[model samples]
Structure formats: structure tokens, C-alpha cells
Target: MSPACFYGDSSALDSILGISRKKTEGALGQHPPSVSYVKAEQDDLLGLQPDEPANPKVLRVAIIGAPNAGKSTLSNTLLGRKVFPVSSKVHTTRCKAYGVITEDDTQLIILDTPGLTSPTKAKRHNLDRSLIQDPWDSMKHADLVLVLVDVSERWAHTCLSSQVLQCLSRFPQIPSILVMNKVDLLKKKALLLDLVTELTEGVVNGKKLHVKSLSRTHLDPARNNPLPSIPACTPENAPKDGGCLQEGSEVQRGPGSDTSCDAKASDSGHVLGGTEKAQTATPQVSRDGKIKKGWPHFREIFMLAALNGEAVETLKRYLLMQAKPGRWEYHSKVLTSQSPQEICENIIRGKLLEYLPQEVPYMVLQETELWEEGPSGELTILQNLLVPKETHVKMLIGVGGQLVSRVAREAGEELMNVFLCDIHLKLCVKLKK
Candidate 1:
């Protein structure tokens, strides 16, 4: 068996139906029993990778970048959904977000990690345990890492981008892609290309500035009022500030013209390698009938570089090409895995069972467990909202259970859209407090 491939133990799966991990040869006899195992072909799990896996394989790719590098934009664009948040502001993405893209029922879970900065960004801000810690932990599960860099800005401002590339280069064997993100704003495109493909991408000392957070309204096209038609709004290719809008700002549509609502962005500018000035053309409709807008330089270039079959297909192939040796030995593909419905239900139930007051003094952290199906086409979620301090309990809980009611309604409504059905969410807080 190749280290990249996995052989699920369909034959000798043990059963522990008695609510515990006990000795049981009759495990296979249990009804609704779930047993799965994986076997790898290579004995040297950490040795040089095989050209082709000896057996079934599980490949992993992790997309990483510095904050505000268009990591979310590229991922969502690649995933073809608003799965991750893409905002002009820095740190809009607080943690790791996972989206499993499946084709013909075959699934690949793509993990989007928060920008890994030097000295780390966790030390600052009021980030709760759940808000960002998830991304940091994602590394342990990653097989390949896609490093993203916002080329539109100056290299001086990229705190850990160079360092990250340095860290990745050390592996040499852990296939990695250096993504030059936000290239739409750069004046010279070639300057960022070599590094983007071979190893790393960035202007050694190019000038770039840090961006500030904007009102949530900026990201939503419907909400942002148009820039003054007069062009004083500076219809530049990309905002110098990495796109957080300015005060009294006219519609600051950049080159890659987007006409979602009343506003319209200009077309994307071309970066034709070398010293040639970029060109901009009008947007056009694709043969598939979807309107295609211009992507800034780094994104546009990277898109072409990584294009294999289709965009998503390219990603699958790229990850597979980058898969390391013996990584599959640690993983298995099991049939009858938990479905989204089951996961959501478990999230609800766990929340209900762990109910606690918001003002609890001692308890610190909480995590959602499972979600169950509800009658009348509703969803019942299981989750635990944990807290570090157990002492602040009374203050967090108010009269008539007002907060608990509010929380249920809010969570229920959110889950309803994803589940494609009404939701009856339940909650609980488990706290040491």
C-alpha cells in the first residue's frame, strides 16, 4: 500500500456496541454498527513520496497567508461560493473555516487558515477561543499548504509573508504553492511572478500600506452607496488601502468591474509580463452565460498558473500532486460517515445540554457537538457553549430566561438557511464556573 493511499478495513472492524471500548468479537454482529480502518502501502510513512500511491489516498491542502492578502477571496473564488468571508479590512477572518467540496459524492475538505503572522496576531484583540484558534490547529491536519501574498501592497508591510515562505521552503518535499494575491493593484506584474511560481512572491522592498477595518456596509455591494460619478472617488485599480472605503467615498469600484447592483467596477487590468503597461478591457459574458470580471494581477496570474482541467479540478490535482508520503497511513475513508444533518443536529443538542449564564465568572470555552433531526422538518442541534470562569454565571443569565430565548431564535434562523428547512435550535452552557 502506498503511503498516500488508504485501505479502509472493511473486513476486520471491531465492534463496541455496549457503550464502551471493550473486548467484543461479536462487534460485527451489532446492528447499525459502524466500523472502519485504513491501511497504507508504504512502511516508511515519512520517507520520500511515491509517484503513485500504492493504495487509496487521502490528500490535504491548506491555504495560508498573511492578513488581508485576499486568501479568502481566492479560496471562495476557487470554491465557487461565499464559503469564507472576504473583506477589505484586515483580520475580517478570525479563524480557520473549512468547506468540503464534493464531486460525484467524493469529498475533499479544504481548510482555510487565518493569516499566519510573525509573533502571531492572537495576542491582540478580544478574540474568543472559538473565533480564531481553529486555524492554528488546522496545521496539524494539513498535507499541503498554499501560501497567499497580497502583491498590491508594499513588501515592507507584509509582516510574516517572507518568513512564512522561508518556513515553507525548508520542507522542500512538502509540495507548496506560493500565491501572489491582490496583484490587481500593482503597477508592475512581472516583479511578483517568479516568486509566485517557483518558491515565494513579493516585492523585496516594494511600498505597501496597512488597511483599516471599515463598516460592514463596505463589503456588501447593495449597502455601499456609489462613488461620486465624477471620479473624485479615485476609481483607481485597487484602493491603496487594500479596499476599506474612505469617508464621503464615491463608489470606489476598482478595475475588475463588478456591476452587481447600482455600482459598477472597471474591467480587470492585464499584467503582460516584463515592463509593459497593463491593459484593461470591458467585461464579457462567458459561454456558460456567467459574467466574468477582471481579477487583479496576482489572483489572475495565479489562476492561470494553477489551471489544470477546470479551477476546482485543478485544485484537486494540485493537492494530489503535492501529497506527502505516508500521510494517508494515518487516515481512512469510512463509509456511512456523519452527514451534514447529523452534524448540525449534534451541534444543537450539545448546545442545549451545556446551557449556562453569559455572565459566568469562571468557565472559559465551549464547542458544539452534534445536531439531530427534529419532527415537522425542523432541526434539533446539540452544542455546549463553554466558559472559563464559573463564577460569572448569575450575571450572564437574566430574568425570565430572556437571553436563552433570544439565542435560540437567532441560531435557529441561521441554521435554517443552510439546512434548507426550518430549525428548532436548542442550547446549553457547560461551565466550570
Candidate 2:
């Protein structure tokens, strides 16, 4: 099938590409589908059953942000365990959902997605960049969107990227919360006020966010504000129509939102913006089809650090309180939708991203070659780290394979903790021809 037809329709694409599936599968060394295409097929291929209508409420939350914004770390913190891998590198998470928190009355299925990036920057290499859009795609499947912003960095213009704005604009009615992550890293506490103002107004560098769609020549940051400044709406003045302001009452920031002195803080896939949900008017787009300037109005603001377990409980409580009359989508016991092999692959990849330098991490891929279950509930796993060049392989192996061994040791410890059993992890670095 032509590249244009690949994303047209799953069934049509599948039918047209029938002959190529075998060859594609073989080239990855009997590997599972590439990261870009796995989400499309994971559920259909696994045949995992949905929840049995036991719980009265279910909250499908989508955690979205730019690469290295710590979405995975937040997910792990929320679940009270590490089901997803946290990495400093970009695009650590492809498309994966973890049915993280389970309450007696509510089940929160967290959809962890790839970080959002500009399509042009993502597709520059022509490598499989499909996962770049996964965050936006996951937004359609979400009942609530937790927009994670890195507040540690100063805001020159807007807090969010254009990609995030475009996705939120597409679903104007879906209430979202602006979560200011890594606030602990903020050296100046007073800057928080400025950060909040910039995010609400969607202005950056004292100018409205620049988008390719609007007439760029007409917009002068000093002369005209292309995007209207959104009126600051506090919780007391929120709209009553269950629209823009409804999401604010759900979270209370700082020590006042039922928490003291610390701050912090979707579903395993059914596409966002399904027909079952109510639809609102689509936001205006520029003539060139580029996203017009408009900052998103968060339902509420949550400031928390996911790494230090700061205010994570407060965020969890807010989610539980969102429970309404609905059936749970995932089984009560399941923590994530990912298979064992996929989890192992993510774990190993996280280590490489942490330890490897330069372009080596991005050019390499890891796959679980074997997963043997022992009688005592232990797991023996073997994974291969595939590199494109011989030099890359040597970098991965280090001198006398010391680097690989270090990666293996750290990966094994985490695996043991997550799986709750003994793990013997073996890493093999191979140069891909």
C-alpha cells in the first residue's frame, strides 16, 4: 500500500498490504509491529476482554506533554508503581495505556502517550515517526486531558507547544487540567504567577503564539494581539454549562486543595472524540489550514513533582472524585494494558536512553528475545539491542561489554521490583545489517 493509504482505514490498509505483512514482520526479526503501528493492532491481536461492568465509575485520562516532559514518571507515580518507563530522552513512550489506579467505585485508566512534537521535526528522518501523533490521537479517546507543562523552565511565550494547542482546539468541549510539572525545580517561587498567566493567555515572549495558519505578515506582537486574551476565570466564576470551567472544581492546587505543603501532579484506548460523547463547535482555523492562535483554558491547575511523590495523592483523590455513573473499562486487577514482552522492551529502552549519549540511543532499538517463566514466579528474560552501525554497537557494548552489563544490572533491579519476582536479564548488542 502507498504511504498515503497506510492511515486511511485499518481494514483497507490491512487488505491492501496483505502480501507485505510477512516481509515486514521478517525484517524486524519476527519482532512485534514497530512502535508506530502497535497500538492499532494491540487490542485486536491480544483479545483482552473489557471490564465486566462492576464499577460505577471510570475515568479515562490522557497524560500529554512534549518529549522529556515526564509524562511516564507521572503515570508511574499515579499508579503507585512503575508500569511505564521514565526517560530523559524524547519519544520514550510509543502508544501504551496503563489501567493504573483502581478504586472500589472508580477505575482510572491512564493513557500514556508519546510526547507531542511538530510533524515536520518528527518526520525529518523518514524513520517511523507515526508515534509523534500518538499524543494527539490519544486525546480523542480521553474523557479528561492532563496537560503536563514543565514549569522548571522559564516561559518566554506560551507554556504549551503548537501541537498540544492544536489537539486541545480540536476537542474544545473536553475539559482539561493544566498540570505544572517539576515545580520543585523552580528556583523562584514568585515566577509561578507569571507562568500561570502565560499558560492561560497562551502568549509567549510577550507575543501571541505564532502559527503557520494565520497571516503571519499581519500579526505584529507589539501592535496587535492575534489571539484574544482569555479572561482569568477563577473557580468561583466558572461557567455553569458543564463547559470550560467544570474541570477546575476537580483539582485544588497548593496546600489548600485538601493537601498541605506539597504540590504535584486515560484509557487504554478507545479513540478520543468518539461518537458517544457530546460534541462542541470546532474552533476557528486559519485560511491556510494552520492552527489559529488561541490558548487553552485549563479547567484547573495542578502543581506537583511526580518524582518526589509530591501531591500525587491529591491528584489521585481528584480523579476518584470524578467518578460518575459508568461501567469500568478495564478489569479491577489489571495495572496496565501492555503485555509482558512490551513492558520488558520499554524497561530496557529506558535504561539505554538514560545511559547512552549522543545519537546512539535514538538509532538503537531493543526487543525482548525471550521471556521464560520459572516455577518460583521468577522470570528469565533475554533482550537484543539492535544498532544500525558497527560503531553504534561498540558504543552500546562499551569496553569489554561493561556498558551493557551496567544497563543489564539496573534494568534487572527495576524488573524485579515491578514484576515482584526474581529476574535474570541478559542483554545482547547486535549490529543490524
Question: TM-score for each prediction?
Answer: 0.39, 0.68
Per-residue lDDT of 190 in model 2: 33
Tens digits of per-residue lDDT for model 1 on 239-352? 433222223222222233212411111111111111112333222336874432211111111322221112233333434433333423222222122344433433333233
What is the Å distance of residue 269 in model 2 from its true position? 45
lDDT of 1: 0.38
Q: Which lDDT value does model 2 have at 315?
A: 62
Q: What are the runs in model 2 whose C-alpha is more than 4 Å off?
A: 1-55, 125-127, 155-158, 202-296
Q: Count the backbone clashes (under 3 Å) in each candidate.
A: 71, 17
lDDT values, one for every candidate? 0.38, 0.59
lDDT of 1 at 202: 23
TM accuracy, model 2: 0.68
lDDT per residue as tens, model 2, 174-208: 77777777867776433444465567553211222
- Among the numbered candidates, top lDDT falls to 2
